[model samples]
Target chain A: MQPQTAPSPQFSLRPPMEAREKFNRLTTWVIVAALLIWSWRGSEMNPMTLFRDAGNIGTLLGDFFPPNFMDWRLYVKEMLVTLQVAIWGTVLAVICAVPLGILSAENMVPWYINQPVRRLMDAARAINEMVFAMLFVVAVGLGPFAGVLALWVHTTGTLAKLFSEAVEAIEVSPVEGVRSTGASYVEEVVYGVLPQVFPLWISYSLYRFEANVRSATVVGMVGAGGIGMVLWELIRSFDFQRTCAVMAIIVLVVTLFDLISQKLRKMVI
Target chain B: MIHVTNLNKSFSGVKALSDINLHIERGEMVALIGSSGSGKSTLMRHICGLTAGDRESGQIMVNGCLIQEQGRINRDIRELRTHIGVIFQQFNLVGRLSVARNVCLGALSRTPFLKGLFGNFAKEDLELTCKALERVGIADKAWQRTSTLSGGQQQRAAIARALVQRAEVMLADEPIASLDPESARVVMSTLQELNRTDGITVVVTLHQVDYAIQYCPRTVALKKGHIVYDGPTANLTRAMLKTLYGSESDDLFGRKEEAPTIVQGAAA
Candidate 1:
């Protein structure tokens, strides 16, 4: 071992930054500041509006005071239907995502397969759940089933992307180990790939389920059937009290499902 | 028995292995010794059909079955692999699965498709896994997650996997490269025992010449993608090694005295 030495006078506490690096850092900050300003103008952001329209907002909110629970039974029933839609949607998505995710992973499949499958997932994810619900409502003629289909398609896209990433990040040696046993391709995936990615997949599925419940509520606004339809009607008819009551129900149900799914996710991971 | 004729492998334009020919008889314990980047691991991988040779080079036959020929693996390579077990240096058992389940995976090719998909091995296969683990002295760790075990234990589990495979040939690629001296002795002795008792043909690659001399009866040496020596281990000498490996002979002749001693007859 080399002998220990005291600090030399030539050594500095911090290294000096090069001119090129300093210039690049300054340029990045300038670009980011310019982009933020441009977006602020494009988005028409106005913090002053809240103070300017305070009276109007107060009057509108006051109209919702003392929420009416006369339609509480209907609100609860439709909320239950929303939960059902989320359940079926999440279950179907989880099933389809397993295969689709494997197909889309670059390490799992060849480029020819992964490229096309990834494009398909991109198409599914590009459109929002509301748009999918609108299209499905036209095809299926407005029902909870349509909402289920919409959430299923969109959630499958999201979950497949997440699942493929997990699969891609796995240690390749375990899969190679399985292959060395003379196991077939599918068997290798089952024994090697799935075991490594199982926990992350479960966590992603639970997270998607929570997000799907929120989407399910809004799908009803497109006549796909849930609490959102009643809420939409009450807003259109200016029944603020009933609308407030319905929003509270939606909040309570979403929170309850989110907590339950969080617990499940924690248990698995 | 295993045979390789004029096998060549190249990554891009640079040759990793070149025009190699070798044959191992049944129940032989042979060691492949080379310095790093000497194509020892690549040759071992080629023998098992895990890696393909150059398109125009040669063919490999393991247990009278064609593993690969001219860069094309046999269509029935998976079935052929069932009879030829391979162990890697990293002990690549699935980390999340139980040790027993990882070992039972050796029976996948024989199990029904649906059964294998669900990881439902036959009762006899499960029993074989138990026996294999017992033979390797890790039966008590059967139900534990594989990642929870020590490196030596994990490596033994891999050996158990090969036992369950009922392989006629066992190829180990630097099985002890990552192990400490004591664990390395245990692993080498285990391979020696299997070759002795079960009559399994064993081929192991090693960078340390001391271990090769102590455990293997036959030694094959590679240098710069070419076979430098293939002979009985007893004929190898310090002068011969210096001539073959030059300055790198020091690495080949590792410090043997620093390695731990084995208890008499414990490995047997």
Candidate 2:
């Protein structure tokens, strides 16, 4: 009898070489070469400059230590104003964004309506908060009022976009179910869409609130009131120590707001 | 009672429903069965006034009210819908809301906006919701978020919402298509029980033939936007199914031979 050899080991039908491997290698080298060239040409960033400026940088940083707590009352008042600005802006934006967001959602509004509304929101969001603050200050002639107006416009644009996308992504079955019950369009939105997105809306509003607190400081640069105005004054006077103190206070306030907002978001969403 | 005559619908130049006529009697359980694109859903949508078709050609009268005639829908279509309840395959319960809240939403048409905003549902409305939930055997889970429930429980909650609507007519669109075998049986039985006990007119769309046989006594089968069969479920034969679905009959009914014995009591 002829000896039977063991069946040959099974071999995979995979191609001997993968095209992706070659493509990845080529792209990796190209990316590294481009980044090296770009970094070298963009700025005359040499270690020598840092070495020369080390003493000045060190002194500027050192001034930040021993933050002046002498003006605690003034700092606290400015902090309260900043908090108020953020709260007012958030509340106003949230209220305005609901209707605008509904109008912008393709699933809720017809294309003719949603198209124009989305374009308006896009235009509103395209400009930065600082530009809006500058324009508001120029129009209203400076103050926390200008800051509030700027924050309102900026937050409305951002929140509208986020809220509309959330609304659009909601399941359609509930809407249809509500419609079948003979509910009006407004009632359908109130019961069907609102329940699904309320948590997400609250979460997004809190997140925007945290961001607005930080932006409220910079709005002061355009003559809008906040701790930023004092920091700007100190910087202009070359009072690095006082500038450091204000910065410390701003950082502390912002960090505390962030923690609160995060906790609230977790609780709701 | 609902009357539909010569209903026609088209989408993107393709006819989805054509010259359809149907009459649904009060307290009758009617099942609409069809292949994927057979116009059952389209016809059901028309009954709910969710879709507009060639109203000039079709006449739809609900409870002596003319809903559609001469290509025009009645302005009171919204009011008509308040008397009809609809359930969906997706359960359609708001995932973030509590089961009780979702059930309470059924009373939104009657509840004032301020009352709804403050969640101040009337005592009777709350009692009705609890009764509806109890009917579906899920009253214990009323306060839980709808998303936390199993698929069967969610569908039950959806049914409870419909029940709380106090609808005289209920339309279920593929209500059990997304459920497992046990859940599907439970949901179908719940609907059957409602129809038998409460005398609510039920018109359900179903993809499974066995379900139509087991629960619904009357079945209307549609094929290619046309009614191929309309008769008692007991009269359905294998040969009729072959004629209705053609070569697809083997795929649809072959599993019938291997079906696990359904525990009737478990469904209840």
Error of 1 at A32 (Å): 2.0
Q: How accurate is candidate 1 locally (lDDT)?
A: 0.93
Q: After superposition, how far is residue B38 of candidate 2 from its true place, in Å?
A: 2.5
Q: Write the per-residue lDDT of candidate 1 for residues A1-269, one digit (tens) a residue.
A: 33344456686786678999899999999999999999999999999999999999999999998899998999999999999999999999999999999999999999999999999999998999999999999999988999999999999999999999999999989998899888999999999999999999999999999999999999999999998888889999999999999999889989998999999999999
lDDT of 1 by residue, B1-268 (tens): 8999999999999999999999999999999999999999999989998889989878899988998999999999999999998999999899999999999998988999999999888999999999999999999999999999988889999999999999989999999999988888888999999999999999999999899889999999999899999999999997899899998888887673256668875554
Worst 10 residues of 2 chain A by lDDT: A1-10
| Model 1 alpha-carbon drift over 4 Å, by segment | A1-15, B256-268
TM-score of each: 0.94, 0.86
For model 2, the local distance difference test gives 0.85
| DockQ scores for all predicted structures | 0.71, 0.56
In order, candidate lDDTs are 0.93, 0.85
lDDT of 2 by residue, A133-176 (tens): 89998899877888888899989999999999999889888877
For model 2 the local lDDT of residue A214 reads 96
